[model samples]
Target: MIERSVRGEAVWIRLDRPAKMNALHLDGWRELYGELDRASEEARVAVITGTEEAFCAGDDIETLDAMESADDVSELAVELRRVLFGIEELPVPVIAAVNGLAYGGGCEIVAASDLAVAVEDATFALPETRIGAYPPYAVERMAELVGKKRSMELALTGEPIDAETALEWGLVNRVVPRSELTDAVSAFVDDVVRSPKESIRLTKRHALAGKPSTGDEDRIAGALARASLSEECRDATQTFLEGGGSEEE
Candidate 1:
């Protein structure tokens, strides 16, 4: 469901599944993690949005329900850890253009994003409890974005929050009309693209300067939350060469 396009140094990654409301399948999760990693290292900025109507309605409940594999839950959880983390671990900023409903996993993705712009009518929720599963990923990310109490309310209640409420609760960076979402995100990404690559990369590293220590070893993979940065690190070295090497810095 990922459609990729590059506008200058900013890459636009869109979730192209309006009919299924962008419900994420396992393949979608892997692809998203892989491509977002590519954009984070190769492009100056990464902007993701939904196609046509919805940013996402979260997981494809139907497909998930039909699956009968014995190890499905474990396998899904493993991939989910990577997918949610792909957004969080990007050294360059990852922006979410929440044009519509960001339910369940969609909300989790938004919570993991570095910055987010939601449309006026956008809604967010974690309704997994209503469906019989726990939103362990969404809960952790949402609690980090908002707070534990509020996130608990949303998670436990399975109620959707409007864009204004989400913004007030600090779930979203800004809210604009649906008409303005595309242009607004584009303009902002353009500004980001104009910035020096290292400035953007350094900004991300500085923001994530210190990793939060989680006592649970199984639940949290602090040190291995992300793999070693081979591409972005190499790209930085090339940028040094493009200038006067050590003399320029």
Candidate 2:
């Protein structure tokens, strides 16, 4: 589930499903969209984070297992893509406070955010290829942020990177000690929020203006649909969920 709270001009959006490492199901995505929409109305900046030991693990395995058709897969992918895009287009800057592991869609969230600050122990990866699926948004945004070569390594290798590597690769803007993560983010947001709101918004818009359009949503949706319906993907996901394969391993 998603929890929302106000902290002066910044709103905090926390993913609270600690038991599952804050992995979101479809309903959770819907709730997040609603929260973001509402928060955008009143907040000058938004900070997204997660509870317990994870910023977010990714999509829920149980939800993925329950998908029965290509159309189902496509619909889920499209909705998630839209939500991430919404975050990107927000008038105010969105900061990801990556406290721990961020994988799959969680990594996509970091890619979409305007800025990110991660704890030293936090890790990031797009491991969809491990289960025969591909992260559609990451295909474009990761490459946009980290360039083609590094993006290819992350997408194709299905391996996790430590916070230092993530910072060196430009996945995150800064990495701080776990104990100082919150203060670092607070200071960063405070500095950003002190700037004129219009200038900040315009700066974000101008930075986004240089991004190349991929126009790959349909192709990505098709790929996700195909992969989600594949026997290998299904079996691999089942094994992982049943404790045969660890996502972090």
Candidate 3:
């Protein structure tokens, strides 16, 4: 589900599960974490992208259904959070090249990255609440990026915002035509790499230093575990996998 390649100092990690709109399963997340860890060792920067049609759709619902208990679900959530935190803690910059639909965890990936560039038509949303789950990491970081009210609106309503709206909300650094996305991201990467590596890392560290702590990860994890065990969420997830209902419904 991940395709890795190296060009110059950049390690590109592509999510390649087009059959599932690039949604990640548990194995996929583990693979991604391993890839990112390797990138931190060997590369000066990492760029994550999706296949031609999607950046990512989100977590694989089928895998979620396979979890036998809330602890199983908690383990999954904690591991995913660890991977995201790994990306954030990487000494080098991690850029997200969002090409298409970035929903749920997909959106969270962009939010977690140091920088992001998106295609004009790409859509972003945090739709976990629609399935009776909440993205705890997203809830923790999004408010700092987009302010509390906007974050609340996005999380509570589970509505998608377009690329323009995403930019306005500070979710993406740049939005370009689909054909120009590669060039745009490349230019951005070029600009980032031109600066002194240590200075850039220090700058990133300082910029992220003010991110507030909520002390709610464990609480949110428990809630997600509980939600996963809910009959409503189970039914909603099955329906979602079957392509039966909108998040709003």
Candidate 4:
């Protein structure tokens, strides 16, 4: 289940499946794309969280481990890669609010986000190899977040990293007391919303560029409003001139 709520300029997106330890299946990835689109279109930044103690314990291994062949795993990996890449490409910044354990696919999602604020009590890992599987999605994406060597160690060993180590490895942007995660993310959201929208979008474009650091690099999308979006310009500019807060048009 994808749950949505708002706090200031942040739209909190929750993955609600605590019964399965918030483990996600292919369908969950689709739902997550929808939730992300909604939040990206409406808010300056997004906070993705899980409903229970674990942010997500990774993919639904029960679904994958019983698969017939390697092709089955590859197909699933491709689709999930599309989802994580989609999140990475969003014009607005996404902040993973990892309140508890974030393993496997959950950690991949956090890897895709621009910022991650993990609670000190939260733990993370990639245990796909332990189940006779590999983490292609995490390899392609998470390597940039925590560097190649660390990612390999975690993936191969299946040992979870505490929040402190994750913070040091740059897996999470900040580590905070579990009780203050929400408030801390909200503060960042408020700061982003008060800034120029285009600037925010453009900055993110440059940031994502760092991920696929190679030739032709001119691919930029959604960071700037097209000339055709005049109505958007009107409203945004009007909001700006009106002091962007309580004042009316």
- All candidates in order of lDDT, best leading: 2, 3, 1, 4
**What's the TM-score of each model vs. the native?**
0.81, 0.94, 0.93, 0.79
The window of 10 residues in a row where model 1 has the poorest summed lDDT is 221-230
In candidate 2, stretches whose alpha carbon ends up further than 4 angstroms from where it belongs are: 215-217, 244-249
**How do the residues 188-210 of candidate 2 rate in per-residue lDDT, one tens digit apiece?**
88999889989987987887797
TM-score of 3: 0.93
The whole-model lDDT of each prediction reads: 0.72, 0.84, 0.83, 0.71
Candidate 4 colliding pairs, count: 0
Off by over 4 Å in 3: 214-217, 243-249
- lDDT tens digits by residue: candidate 4, 165-205: 99999998889998999888887777778888899888988
Give me the runs in candidate 1 sitting further than 4 Å from their true place: 209-249
Model 4 misplaced stretches (Cα beyond 4 Å): 69-75, 213-249
| Candidate 4 global Cα RMSD | 16.3
Identify the leading candidate in terms of TM-score. 2
TM-score comparison, 3 vs 4, better candidate = 3
Arrange candidates by TM-score, descending: 2, 3, 1, 4
* Residue 242 error, candidate 1, Å: 60
